[model samples]
Target: MFAPMDSTEIFWVATICVLLAVELATLGLTTIWFVGGALIALAAYECGAGMPLQLILFTCV
Candidate 1:
């Protein structure tokens, strides 16, 4: 599990950044969809989602 880096906003942002980087690198819309998912988790995290729920929200986008 990830430790120390406990802030969900940071995690979501980092994930979106990486996703965007991947999208930009390959210009693949696949990563763009995942970026959307990360945004959803960001919103849910703002609403106080737990890690499990946040992960699920990320997966569902």
Candidate 2:
């Protein structure tokens, strides 16, 4: 049996993708910073950080 990714992981990844897409489409710096934060949170999620920790890192980044 293959298990799917958790909801949190899915959301974070989706957020990262969407942010990158929007940033690229606009070629703007606004969302780039957010993309950095989202990437950090996504990495943290992959490293097994909890939601609260992810949110904190996202905000700090």
Candidate 3:
């Protein structure tokens, strides 16, 4: 099955969600930022942005 949105965005968001859930379930600080970063990348991709911009956004957030 395929996502309704761009493939890159779908995968990244799914990965983000998975990471976030795991982080929450485990109560660990680790890996949450990476998941957030992926979410940032996914949003950037959907917005027609580039990797550099997404990285910047993720780092700043």
Candidate 4:
């Protein structure tokens, strides 16, 4: 069985995946920043940051 993951974690992971797919399909590199942002948000979530903090990290990173 897969390891249990929080819904927020799944959301960030899915965001990263979709952004990556879009970046690959277009190769325009625009979504790369979003991928980085999602990664930061994921890390923040793993560190138990609140949604507001996670969002700030996502936007600032």
Please give the lDDT score for candidate 1.
Answer: 0.85
Ranking by lDDT: 4, 2, 1, 3
Residue range 1-61, candidate 4, lDDT tens digits: 9879978999999999999999999999899999999999999898889999999988887
TM-score of each: 0.81, 0.83, 0.63, 0.91
Candidate 4, TM-score vs. the true structure?
A: 0.91
Model 1 over residues 1-61: C-alpha lDDT tens digits?
8555456688889999999999999986788989998998888877877889978977886
Q: Count the backbone clashes (under 3 Å) in each candidate.
A: 0, 0, 0, 0
Q: Candidate 3, residues 1-61: lDDT per residue as tens digits?
A: 9657766676777888888889999887887888878877777888899877877877775
Clashing pairs in 4: none
By how many angstroms RMSD does model 1 differ from the true structure? 5.2
Tell me each candidate's RMSD, in Å, in order.
Answer: 5.2, 1.9, 3.4, 1.5
As for candidate 3, its clashing pairs are none
Which tens-of-lDDT digit does each residue in 12-55 have in candidate 2?
88998999899989996889888899889989988999899999
What lDDT does each candidate get?
0.85, 0.90, 0.79, 0.94
RMSD of candidate 3 to true structure, Å: 3.4
